[model samples]
Target chain A: MSTASPVLDELLDALRCLPGVGARSAQRMAYHLLERDRQGGGRLATALQAAMQRIGNCVECRSFSESERCALCAGSTRERSQLCVVETPADLAAIEHATGYRGLYFVLLGRLSPLDGLGPEELGLPLLQRRLAQGEVRELILATNPTVEGEATAHYLAELAQTAGVRVSRLAHGVPLGGELEYIDRGTLAHAFGSRLPLN
Target chain B: MSTASPVLDELLDALRCLPGVGARSAQRMAYHLLERDRQGGGRLATALQAAMQRIGNCVECRSFSESERCALCAGSTRERSQLCVVETPADLAAIEHATGYRGLYFVLLGRLSPLDGLGPEELGLPLLQRRLAQGEVRELILATNPTVEGEATAHYLAELAQTAGVRVSRLAHGVPLGGELEYIDRGTLAHAFGSRLPLN
Candidate 1:
């Protein structure tokens, strides 16, 4: 997109660093900012700079924070006996929003993948072990995703919890609430069938 | 996404100013930058600020430029007798890349949409008139899009060119090359049928 403008070219290239943006979308975004929304573009730039410079991981849960501890970890009212562990801050947000659970959270930031060089230390398991050793938590809920890596991370965390004398639980894997059994996948149907709960 | 972080909230809100980003994409982008690509995010911030503050319209052609006149308009080798008028700089770039046209360009930055408060003055018709009055251009090529507003703008520009005693031409509109007749839309097929060209 050599519009005979070097600044425009630089902007287009910079916009492609986003996750799903490609060449065409980058061009569109650049043109949009230059033509119609310079103010918004400036605001976005300020926000991006501030976030990148100031936001850091919480000392306790390792979630993004501007201070030493995140707001969630700093709050006094939330139950500390039940710790829900998730892979990312987004997952923590989902659990916080959807469920009534008032327990604290531990964000892994990523799953354990040796191939990608993500090990126990990368997931902050040592910090988690120290937190479990404090005896403040009685239950460690494995709220990781249902993927293979998520399950493996959960297994590892379960052993850590057992060593710390804490109970462990996992999120249920079954057909969705409103989904028909006919439309459910075979694996989910099998898992639900195998783990069917008795009616009272 | 009340991640219990005000900075994160601000970042998400600012990200939504982009064209296609929404709630979910904003969250995903924020988390991605904080977790995976802080350096890229910082670079993007710098690029955005620099482009927004420094990039301005070329006085000669109304295209984006860092200086008073764009490189294309300032070049001495291009044909001065043929001036192409386009709705946007992106259109100018598309013509530059896809064809052998070596004429200078006048970018409107927008078409004449009266409902949106766009008129002759807004499209820089006064500046264009002064250019045409110089009498150096022998032909004016109307390369605006084929939309309704585009056609109206082209008609207005054609009259302007005629008043200056310059020959006027437009980009041909019809079925695209290699387009099968069976799959082509009705309007394009009908237009192609009506404007059948005579073979040399």
Candidate 2:
């Protein structure tokens, strides 16, 4: 028989919806919320409610936004001729943090997964094609993950962009910065070797 | 220059208030809430709000409760003569889950830490003494953690229970069940050895 209070059990189960949280972590989170930081928990609740209600997919890029278009899509100063496609908003955020990629972005939200019934349509490929057919964008950068499904999605998108007369490029595959040769994965090392650039 | 939207940032920051949640985990949680399960996120928010607002300390045992007294404290079926003292409601719940110990519980909520300004008063030792002075409890179980502060607090509480003419007992310290001796900590190994039991 479960000994947990009904409300506590409900809260614990609800917390499991978060990524990477397990039963123990959920329990700890529930306790912390109830015992120590009720005010903070209340603030979290308010924030979650407000964010969920207000945030929606940006019309143009499919990234999360409170308005119809995200700030990146709405900004006039971004390079309209270049478009960067990413699998998720988190990936878009990472690129935006690291590089001066002033180009507009298209967030696929997820890659094609036939087993899971996710398809080109699910990834908004038709919309991407329409954007490419507009003939304003000169270059398309594929910044999706380097996994097998990400590769398939990238290839599919590349075909679509090339058909629409837009040049397509993929992010470089290499040993990560500050990584040792022995520690790097074999696939990454092989890719880095294959994509080796000439000396300046 | 953060590219995160305002509401997204707020949600991320709010998630950090959870125990063991760092900036990256909070960001991941925020993204999960915003991207995948807005409905579940809404549920979590509602649960947090409701639990925080409704749950308070049980007047008798100091365990979390939605009403004036916790179910354990309110239940007449429990052994009122045996009071088990625990550091937190989580610890109390753990004990309840593992054992058929039908005794009432007193949750300290925290251990005594002089360096952190936590003391007997902070742990409601006076209230505990008053409860002990009522003279109905035959045994006072010291189930505070096995840390240094936990031991000190146990000693302090043991003295209080002895002064009130109640017997004091502590949770056994030993190598945990299913634990390998090689992997056990020295303190635990030493305690296990020191408290070795004779075979019947």
Best by TM-score: 1
* CAPRI docking class of candidate 2: medium
Error of 1 at A189 (Å): 2.7
Candidate 2: clashing pairs of residues: none
TM-score of candidate 1's A chain against the true A chain: 0.96
Instruction: For each candidate, report its DockQ versus the true two-chain complex.
Output: 0.79, 0.70
**What lDDT tens digits, residue by residue, belong to model 1 across residues B59-168?**
98898899998898898989989999999977887889899999899999899999999999999999999999999989999999999999999999999999988999
List of clashing residue pairs for candidate 1: none
User: What CA root-mean-square deviation does each model show from the true structure?
Assistant: 1.5, 1.8
Candidate 1 stretches with Cα past 4 Å from truth are: A180-183
- Per-residue CA lDDT of model 2 for B1-200, tens digit only, reads 25548988888889999999998788788888887889999999999988988888888888888888888888889999999999998898799988989889999989999899998888888889999999889999999999999999999999999899999999999999999999999999998999999999
A54: Cα error in model 2, Å = 1.0
- Candidate 1's error at A49, in angstroms? 0.5
